[model samples]
Target: MGNIQKITPNFWFDNQAEEAAQFYTSIFDDSEIVKVSRYLNEGQEIHGQSEGAVMTVDFKLNGQKFVALNGGPQFKFNEAISFIVHCATQEEVDYYWDKLSEGGDESAQQCGWLKDKFGVSWQIIPDILPELLSSSDRDKSEKVMKEMLQMKKIDINLLKEVDQA
Candidate 1:
């Protein structure tokens, strides 16, 4: 915990940096808001945001460093980059899926992936997914993949059942 992170993931949000940081910190354990900065006459004309408005929020999610920037809407979050939450249990998956997907675009959810209210994409995947998918049995892995593709929230129990089928 004392060592500094080498590379931090930065998220660009359209005026929701503080809110998003708070939301994420509240959901994750050992998380906290470290600092916050405001825009003060820097790139004002291009950014088009008011002075003194929140420009950045530095936070930690489960002890991992992350930055949330209040950048303008020049860029939008897409499937190009997403954070995958590797859950060890079905309960963890359910909790994260339910919490992150609240007030988010439900229709965008597919294969344990969903876009949060702030438009950030997240994958609430179970830890057993990769193990089962990489199994030597092609038929079972294929069935697991097939079932995964058809569901919004992943059903680990169903995947396990199909893996043994």
Candidate 2:
């Protein structure tokens, strides 16, 4: 495959590269697995993976490119890095939140941020959030900010009502 994207995010997994790629592809529209590569005996001493085992998976989600690597447990994903999903409507927000957060870390959920079962952090935000939070009217912005801080998943209707109030 050609390097169409200048930069691509690579996810390092202990051994779930293919699984995670499949899960992510299933959650988004216009997504699919592009290619998969297996470990070769030449790197057995360094990678410590069995021959022919999954080593990397190339995939696309809604046109965004990503790579998943079976890099072992030397490192792990954290909240410091997260993928943001911007939703145009409440239904869109709800759909992504419910699907991505399944079997995920519930305690990490706050202000529309969640950690999936694979420990990858994600922020599910409304498209109007920036406008609401950055409005010139401090009163409206403050109300939205306060309400947002108290939410695990953003309630667009409540935010809108609070903004109007």
Candidate 3:
């Protein structure tokens, strides 16, 4: 097979690497476990234990490759970086928003920004966002964006109304 493209997001869990992977994959469609590689006898050890348990897990979500690690809790997911998913329709937006926000906090913002239980942030934006933002009318676009910034989970209809005004 050709070189498979992957967007690996390393997670440092205390000991919940596998559980986190299963929980995440189960929440998305077309997602499944790809591979699980535990620590080998020759690998480095942590806390006097050799061969780190659940060293890495390769998984896919909606066809996107992601790798999870059971590294120690030296770091955690923050709001600095987030995944932005462009939805073609309101239905798609709702589906992702609801699913992703199940055990996470929903933030208020134009477009879409939500934080899952894992504290990993995501932006579920509409495909039409670019179109609206790039419109010739800067004032209208700004208005639409401002309106979006104040709400949680983008509403395409509201944005369209703002665009028309």
Task: Output the number of the lDDT-best candidate.
Answer: 2
Which lDDT tens digits does candidate 2 get at residues 50-81? 99999999999999999999999999999999
lDDT value for candidate 2? 0.97
Candidate 1 stretches with Cα past 4 Å from truth are none
Residue range with the least summed lDDT across 10 consecutive positions in model 2:
1-10
Clashing pairs in 3: 110-148, 110-149
Q: Rank the candidates by lDDT, best first.
A: 2, 1, 3
What tens digits encode model 3's per-residue C-alpha lDDT throughout 1-165? 977785466666666778778987987789998999887777364433356467778888888888887766778887788888878999999988888788786542334888877777889999998899888999998998898877788899999999998
Best by TM-score: 2
Instruction: For candidate 2, list the clashing residue pairs, or say none.
Output: none
lDDT of each: 0.93, 0.97, 0.80
Off by over 4 Å in 3: 40-52, 107-111
**Residue 22 miss distance in model 2 (angstroms):** 0.6
